[model samples]
Target: MDAEQSIADEPEVTEKRGLFGRNKLATSEPKPAKTLGPLKMIWAELAKYPGKVALAFIALVITAAATLAIPAGFKLIIDNGFAAGGNPDDIGRWFRYLLMIVGVLAVGTALRFYFVSWLGERVVADIRLKVQDNLLRLAPGFYEENSPSEISSRMTADTSLIEQVVGTTVSVALRNILMGIGGTIFLFWLAPGLTVGLVIAIPLIILPIMYFSRRVRNISRSSQDRVADVGSMVSETLGAMKVVQAFNQESREKTRFEGAVEAIFDTAKKRILLRALMTSIIILFIFGSITLIMWRGALGVSTGEISGGTIFAFVVTGGLVAGAFGALTEVYGDLLRGAGAASRLNELLKAKPSIAPPERPQTLPLPPRGSLSFRNVTFRYPTRLETAALKDFNLEVEPGETVAIVGPSGGGKSTIFQLVERFYDPQAGTIRIDGVPLASADPAEIRKRIALVPQDGVLFSSNARDNLRYGNWDASDEDIWEAARAANAESFLRDLPDGLDTYLGESGTRLSGGQQQRIAIARALLRDSPILLLDEATSALDAESEQLVQQALDNLMQNRTTLVIAHRLATVRSADRIVVLEKGQIVEQGTHRELAAANGLYSRLAALQFTSSDAA
Candidate 1:
């Protein structure tokens, strides 16, 4: 196999082996968590706003207390207000007391909703910030094994689930627990015999609901996965719409998306069906028990063992208790879903970059020297451990020198740039910038001294000024124009409607290929780093554009150490030295004419290109 293809075909790491794996978002669902323990992560975030939490809890308690108080208030009204020959003033007083309880319940519920929802929104925002901060710290290899789109889904969908848990589910669960306990006590107070019967029936009400709930929970997870599949499909198809249309595969894409949508519908049906069954069981057991208790209470009332007021209070409070428990069963399932979301987010939060500066890091020397060296380097990508991209490679470039590397595809051309920037650590070798080993120096410091113009000009969705000054954020407008002039970008940039302030479309798509490449060259020029890496920088340009960019590069490289990777042999004829590589080893190194005369790999490659040019 070609070396480059071998490198590209490496298997992604699957150590965690579930949702984090590449393409796993649509293909797999994580195992359902056995408990709600993962929700503690959400609690930790909630704990940051202690005052809000306290207010919410206070409001929740008040609401529950007021809810139970209504029954007591009703008991007074029924027993006294309508008592035979009761005083008119006494009747009005009892009615007013009941109305007051209703008012308190209303106000307390609004407060509870406000505070809990505030906590929920605040926690999710904080978590998103923290997760994003960690994601930026990770190395490129991490992304190779993990799909960014899947990670984004976790950021959005999972966080939304957590928001619901914090804002609604937890609050509901707590309030109901208070009501269930408080209401049950009131029930026993009104009629002990009846409360006993109600209590005994509680397990029967909960058991069947729990059974159906387990089924619902499993299907709920699958339902979420199916929805994620639909989302991924839409994103994938839309992102490659041009390709789909170009190949006339629109129908195939439509069919694929329809399949995903149908899958979601199927999964949702199972979850909803189970939920419906659970709801039915809750009603049957709870109301049926309430009816039986009322029948028994009626007998006591007839015997004068209980007042009509007492029986009314008992039944009302008993209903509240039963309703609370029923709500709890549903709340438990929601909490578990939140726990699953928390677990996934927690993984991202806890992820440590494989490459990080050591404690007591060695600092690169002041007054940057454009010197770089690779010593006995033998390395394979994490995904492709069997094939080495670079093997026993050694080279050194002095300050202010230019070295051109030309080779067959996948001759470790791009791999050299990868290591120089410390994107990956070689399994066996030491790479140094200014004589400081990369592992001992901060990766940021190593990268600060090198500027790269990759095969493609990568730009962000921002204004031209921001894209131009990306490498040097502090660059003045004057400095920017100077760099642009050197990069042959100033002419067209000045012609833009908004000049430097014009918004560049995503990835600079509005710009032509040559224009984007020139912008990239200008960016590197603005960086003014000691060392430069040009990976086929002019390969994408037309003849005129290439000449202009090559001129700009010449000015840019005057005082810098430059490493150029090119397949076009004519471009490197003037380099200080040329190195030829094949099958991950350096086969020859010399001046271009010397290598051309030697009839080695470089000579043959140069012959192929120059001969083709002459024929054309």
Candidate 2:
């Protein structure tokens, strides 16, 4: 089965490589080691919108400056405007000036938010598009080793975290840094001795907080992981509800979900407790230092060593500095999280497709003859390197010829289709379409001449029209109807509520297994490719549906080159030639009557199948 189908069938907790190559629970967020270097990718994206970035930066500076000016404005109102002999006009002027600064602060802060948020959303949108584009270029082998579920989570959860970093965290960090620096300078100007004392106390306050914050962060990560665990369990249980009910295991499932929820609650409780302790410690240190500073300032006021306005400004600015630094402590952790997200996203963005067009690709011959040849091909799937799927296999099919490949389960019947599509290059072979080597031509060009009907019909979540037209996007409604009629899908297609416009639902769940297979056949008919591949195309259909579809396929195969993989020996009786594969090698090849008479492997398989059919 494909990776996506496997993940859907069994939604178990798996492990994926973390940011630094260590395996971790897939549900947990990736953690970055010591550096935020991956943020450079975000910067690269941000650089695309220079005007918006510049505007945000300018507004950020204005807001920070306005914030610092507030304390100075208050000091002027107190020392000059509120003095004993001050005129009412002087008081009014200072108050108006302070109000003006507030106006600028409000406008600048709004502008900063708007511009920063725009840049964040734009950058994320671009990254997602680029990542998806690269993902499309990747070969199927990549999906074999990586879970689509984990990759999907990175695409969504990781990108959303990046959006937060761009929109909120980075802006807050920059603004707070400016405020912290500006506030500290102002504090020193107001009272040098007091500023030195505050600076010394700053480390003592921050060091303990930092240590506590580290513990809190770790607990918070664990808490989030537990919540993710709960979410995964809920999804798994709901997805398999039918199986659970059939097995009378609803009570077991309930207990399992309850256990998951309690685990989440327990982790949350620890995080909350740590955060509460941290908050209490922060309050004691911050307020205690403020009290000491206030007492010293009070003595200075009594001795007339400094004015009331100066001490007041000093105290206010000191609070602003402390708050700024505290906000900064949280910023680093957020940046680290963003860095982890960026690293994972970068991995996707930077991935080079293993199967790609060469620098100079050879164009396939015009007016395709659909002739395909496998010359001494030896191939192995990347995941199974030790076992060759095809060992020195050779085959040649001319235009307008039908070749049926009959095989047991692991006999390399499907590998031929994969090689013909150029999804992977064989380890030792030259596969050619119309005399053009696959490796020398673009994969798109190679696949354009081929059509495939898989054992299971795969459909997208869309209207029937779209699903049918997927094989040939430009096919007209009339063309689609003709193909549907040929595939015996016209009656069912017209019976739907909205006809062609009815939503097919995910994977065409609205259609029956036989109906879905017919739709798949109709799609291939619409493709009008010269080379057709049918991998148990009628496997899901009933006897009648199979017979009708087989007649349609026979008509379609008359002029096209066809390769059929059929386990039902009866289906290949009319083929020009039948090749029976065993363990990656063709053990016998002949007409049905000839092979059956020879009493070889093909004869044995045919005897067993025919006997089973007779018994039924």
Candidate 3:
């Protein structure tokens, strides 16, 4: 066997593996999330805590009532304290009434704060959990169009906005609305003529409010999108920092990040400027109308059309109404912003993954024997529908047999593994395992019968034991060590200070490429599925490590149906049958000796490898 019989005769396997590995598992599009009005969705979330919501509303009502009663208390203090027959006891009793109302106001305000704040925190937590769970269940195809960074931003920034609206802003708006209505009623009773003067300027205030409401909503939505863009840039750049530095692209990344930040600033500036202009207009109209109305009330008191106390009560009550009206504008802006956040979260929750179990899914065959067949399978990635990844491909594998698929890049090698795993249903074909068509079986049931080790060794930021246990969550410690030993990974795992408890950093950065691949193989071994799919499993390993892992693979493949996607000819020489694929079709297939004797594509590739090895 020539040394160059490996794919090292061509470009490195690692480089080719990267290109072929992408877009392999393209699932069907998920069900579109329902587009619900933001307020309606928020109400549904709040409805989950009916008792708390009731208590909060009751507290809010009491607080508003207390504020309204204060103006009445002032009237009593003025009228009774200085009555024509002015009894000393009566004056003292009126003061006592005022003090009692204040006490009620204090308790109600505190209760309102506690209940609303608690509700806000609780509701936001529930929303975040729902979004997270739904995201996990969504098809991987969703990530092709949407960035993880943007999704994360919605979970953090958008949820925070919802919390503020739910906790404090909602109660504040309701209270102000109550105050405005109560104050208006009292104003008309106290001095009807002056009340009429204040109502006339309502049109002036309403016009500006309408203008700001539309602009704030549109601008706020854009502002949020811009912020998410900034988050996406930061996440993408940081995750790829190694590549960025290796290519000396730090300055370019910084410039890209700065552009994202400036986009956010520009959007925010428009929103803030509109809010400021609206606030200025509201203040001018509210206090301007109050000044003119109160001047007439003072004149009425001098002429005897109204008493001195009545004039004071009218002016004070009118001031309360104007202040409440002003606050309503601010509250309206908050509600708008919160709506945008709620709308985003609702969309995420409503999305249903395409690969979810049918309403009445068929049960898979019991005691899997690992036989699989593909009849005229044709497929294209959901994201790349124009380009066919596999076209009318046909194959069959017997139980306990090992079949190696050898092909150039993008020859449907990885696509076969994806179809076997049922990540993406072929556009046209009948794929069966144990004589049962895949469409007739539940997706989860199909996956349980198969184990996969792709080109990359996917590892999470978790301990060694936890990562290994991911293959079979209920597996025992003894079983875990057994699988690791079988994969030739037991020695390195034993060397670590914490043994199985050693924390694997993000993506197993603590381990070398060969070590990570070994761990991946160990994970698959722990699954102990009836069928196994290995895609370039040893393509990245050094010579010494490859020899050891290859031996482990041989042991694991015993008595199991195995399909190998190999770039290196030397690795698959022992396979029971070899299939040469080109342009998504099987071009030639035979054992190593048969293909070499035929002097076909396989012979040419083998000759290149041997000649390259001889030159070295």
**Over 4 Å off in model 3, which ranges?**
1-38, 82-96, 128-134, 202-287, 307-313, 358-360, 495-497, 541-552, 603-611, 614-616
Residue-level lDDT for 121 in candidate 2 = 94
User: Once all C-alphas are superposed, what RMSD does model 2 give against the true structure?
Assistant: 5.7
True-structure lDDT of candidate 3: 0.79
User: What lDDT tens digits, residue by residue, belong to model 2 across residues 1-616?
Assistant: 1212212222234566543234576643445536989999999999999999999999999999999999999899888998846799999999999999999999999999999999989999999999999999998777776667767888998888899899999999999999999898888888999999999878778887878766765666566567768888889989998999999999998898899889878877886787778778878998899999999998998998887888888888898898799778778877997898898889988878989999999999999999999999999998789999999898889897888998788999998888888888999989999999999999998888999988888899999999999999999999999999988889999999999999999999999887888888889999999999989887767888787777667756768899998866556876888988887888999788788889888877876767745313
Candidate 2: count of backbone clashes, pairs at least 3 residues apart or interchain: 0
lDDT of 1 at 48: 91
The true-structure Cα RMSD of candidate 3 reads 11.0
> TM per model?
0.85, 0.89, 0.78
Tens-digit lDDT track for model 3 on 186-268? 88888788888777776676677667766776677567567657777788889988999999999998898888888888877
Give the distance in Å from residue 467's predicted Cα in candidate 3 to where it truly belongs: 1.1
Residue 72, candidate 1: alpha-carbon lDDT: 93
Best by TM-score: 2
